[model samples]
Target: MKTSLRILIVGQNGQVSQALQRRLAGMGELIVLGSSQLDLAQPDLIRAPIEALRPNLIINAAAHTAVDQAEGEPQRAFAINATAPGILAQVAVDLGAALIHYSTDYVFDGRKPEPYTEDDTPNPLSVYGRSKLAGEDAIRQAGGQHLILRTSWVYSTEGRNFLLTMQRLLQEKPQLRVVADQVGAPTWASTIADSTALLIERWQRGQPGAWGTYHLTAQGETSWFGFAQAIGESLVRQHKPCAMLEAIPSSAYPTPAPRPLNSRLDCSRLLREWGVSQPDWRSALQQCLAGQA
Candidate 1:
């Protein structure tokens, strides 16, 4: 790595952003920007802050992640998730820096019985998914050195995510109905950050893998009900009131945006190429919960 390497992260307070900040501390100089400092919805103003920093690596960890809420806010979603990524890619090219942006498995419609691969064609079912797919396209169109890491079911000890929500609701309620049909790995934010650090280390050693899209997530899969059961098990071990988790189909719980039935992502390519691997969803979740204790 260059001795004077400068890194600019385009988010703060987000699960992935906070993890990235902690993981990349000694790698280089970090300039993390929250929405107050750099609103992704304001595309026109993104370039100025980036250009001023002139970072060697720009990590975009921000996005309009409210899946159901995005249905009624297409313009804001597109502005942040689609337009902003394109702009970030453009600025990355101008600055001669590599960009690392996070994507999602929502790009796929989830009809495939097997896990979605990077080679699979994307057909988004919801506004959030469409906006994210557009962002991936915009980045590719910009033609810069970039990594569009498409991950699934991200959660952590902090922020608004599945893991935290389950921890709270499981103790508060006597019974909880979770979607059993919708299946995917519950990936911890720390795993993504640590893997990202490893990727950067490889690049610094001058042995980087192919620059493009790749899947990053935990090793195993589970449904929302399965995940909830696991969370309840943890609470039970802690002598807390554990909710009785009832498994129900997605049809039982309606939301504004449609969710994919299968969200499992094939991560073999990332492991094969980058030599990065992840713990099983169960183990990662345990470690994440342990951190809370």
Candidate 2:
């Protein structure tokens, strides 16, 4: 008995949500629910919609992503990032639908010099990290068919991310101070969306099983300093005026929530299972910047 795959994409207005919606276009019957339509902070709000639609797949692009803010509002973060996803996962279990949830590399403490793998124990440093880790645990405990993908440094031209921040700052200021201690891949949401869709295609074809976790990030990594320089370089290539990018220690620019110094996520397991290699961070950045221009 072949069942037509009905897809549901949560978080309609977000950068990742919009990117996923664009990629999933014409793929299947996709139901997109915004926070207004379905408040993730209140998981019960999703029950009626899930019952009405009975989707074959649920892609959770919704999250409480304010890292520093989460430090002061742990309870709210837990409500949206942890508890909400748990309830959704339970619903998916009852409906026999596959749950695709995204996680963050912040699950690690950033103590390791090398890339962290899925097998590594999670030691979240901030409230946001803890909440996301809780969400992962909840879905795992639910015993539902799930694929958990942990990624980092996500950016899109439309969002309030590093790239946009740099673009705006470089326009106004003659010089900028960027933290160089933090290291991670600068992943574009478009690539992440496309890669996720490819994974879903395989899952529908009976390749993906009930449970798995994988890291999804760009091929290489760079410190925040290097990232800023690359952005400046891109601006120059685009014939836009460049700004002076200065690299400073993390200590110089402290935040309410401490960022991980090392965010290198090992994607070997991700590649081994998905059979897809991540695109280079520089190349991805080039396309993204060009699109913005």
Q: Global lDDT for candidate 2?
A: 0.88
The residue pairs that clash in candidate 1, if any, are none
Q: Locate the minimum summed-lDDT window of 10 residues in model 2.
A: 203-212
Compute each candidate's TM-score over C-alphas. Answer: 0.99, 0.97
Q: Candidate 2, which segments miss by more than 4 Å at Cα?
A: 1-3
Candidate 2: the clashing residue pairs are none
Task: Quantify all predictions' global Cα lDDT against the true fold.
Answer: 0.94, 0.88
RMSD of 2: 1.5
Per-residue lDDT tens digits of candidate 2, residues 1-293? Answer: 12577899988877889899999887788899888888888866768878788998899999999999999899889989999888888989999998899999999999998999999999999999999999999989887788889999999988689888888798789989999999999899998998888888777677763367889999899998999899888888778887898889999998998888999999888678777668999999988877877
